[model samples]
Target: MRIVIALGGNAMLQRGQPLEAAIQRENIRKAAEVIARVAKDHEVILTHGNGPQVGLLALQNAAYDKVSPYPLDVLGAETAGMIGYMMEQELYNQMPGAQIATMVTQTLVDNNDPAFQDPTKFVGPVYGKEEAEALAAEKNWSIKADGEYFRRVVPSPLPKSIIEVEMVKKLSEMGALVICSGGGGVPVRKLEDGKLEGVEAVVDKDLTAALLAEQMGADALVIMTDVAAVCVNFGQPDQKKIHKASVQGIGELDFPAGSMGPKIDSCAQFVEKGGRFAAIGSLYDVEKIVTGEAGTWITNEVEGISFYEKKEEAAVA
Candidate 1:
């Protein structure tokens, strides 16, 4: 099977944890064990989130006065390389014979996207109200309250196209386990002359992963997140996990924009665009999830067993 896997940021870095190289490397090693098993049977293409890493870079810049601060797009690319190196090294150790490659992917976005005018996507470290106001004044950063803490905000534009789609597809066909389109692919815009220019925005990683899956004709798009399944009323007492759902059915559920919302949308979009299936689950259980033992599978049909269910049923029958 050909699969495109999108790894979540928090899955790599936990809440209130120190941002240390050792911690990140260990996390990748754990994730790679799961990925290595999948690569044994599937043509795997990996993508990952860079929210925490890029935010760390931003914070580092804030602390240093001598160095020039990098833009979000550039920072996204940097994290892609940094994380990709870690993933490559770990995956190589775990899956010795597999050929792994990382691409600095570029995703196209419209120049006039409304998100450009109104930056609402949060990035970087959380802060108190007083600290937020102080940083806003000193660095001219846009700050927004996230639950109880404040965070830096940036534009989150829609992903229109994947510039390296053909290259990615070709590499996959050649039996290469590829990692590309990290952090929604360094959001860029194409000029009239056909030159691509980087923008000061972040593209939703789920959306970009879906696009990559579609473009590469992937059999499945497995979104590895912190949660095992899509839940209704997330974090509330009434919260319930959905084991299987259709594209339309997921749309009916209430999901927050900054959380489980985009993931559901990405799965729905993939299925709607003629893709086979999309799975959402925890990174730790990726092998089990892919083998039909865990995760929520979203598909177009609702009458029969889900993809995972059908696989298990077939195996038993």
Candidate 2:
């Protein structure tokens, strides 16, 4: 089967972990091990989150008074290149004979997207309430609470189209493990005269991943994040993990906007747009997740849902 795997930021850099090159490389190495296993059986295309990395670049540029900070589009490109290299190298180490390639693809977004007016996507390093407040006031920047810490917020517009999608398709068809669309393909917009220009926005990675999957005619779309499964009543004591759900069923429940919400929404969009099923789960559980052994699988089948607990009981019987 052909699979499009979207790696969440946690797959590369853990929350609260320093963004050191060594730390990121080690994490990618671990992730590559799992991905290599999947590549052995399935044709794969990879994409990943770049919130932490882009934010770090923005912060670093902000500190250097010698030059103006580059726009988010450029930073997105930089992170794509940076992260893609590490992922490609690590994947090569894990699967020596496999052909792995990375591309800094481009995704177009509407210049007039409402996201520009409402910059809700969080980025950069997390800061304490007090520090975040101070920074927001001093820098005149939009800020938002991310878990216990606060970070800068940016517009996360929906991806309209992937510019280099054909190339990606060509590479994957030839059985190459291709990694592209880092930071959602460096957000761009088309001008009136047919020229393309970069935008100051972030394109949600999961949404772009769905677009990639649809374009590639993939059999499965797996979103690998830090969480083991998608849970309902997430923080409550009675919270339950959803093993399998119809796309429509998953849509009926509400999830936090900042975290898992976009992932579920993107997955639903994929199945609705003619892709097979989509799975949301941990990177560590990737092989099982894509195979329907783990994660919250969202499908378009008539049967509503199948709970993992029940499946396990049936096996025991």
In every candidate, how many clashes are there?
Answer: 0, 0
* Candidate 1 clash pair list: none
Over 1-65, each residue of candidate 2 has an lDDT whose tens digit, in order, gives 99999999988899999989999999999999999999998899999999999999988988998
- lDDT of every model, 2 decimals: 0.84, 0.90
Best by TM-score: 2
lDDT of 1 at 214: 92
In candidate 1, what are the lDDT values of residues 1-317, reduced to their tens digit?
Answer: 89999998765776556789899898889889988888988899999988778888988867887977777889899999999999998999998877899999999999999998888777776788999999899888888887788888888999999999999988888989999999899999999998989998888889999999999888899999877666666678775556667887777767777677788899989989988889888887787667656787788766323333434433322
Q: For every model shown, what is its TM-score relative to the native structure?
A: 0.91, 0.96
Kindly give the stretch of ten consecutive residues in candidate 2 with the minimal lDDT sum: 308-317
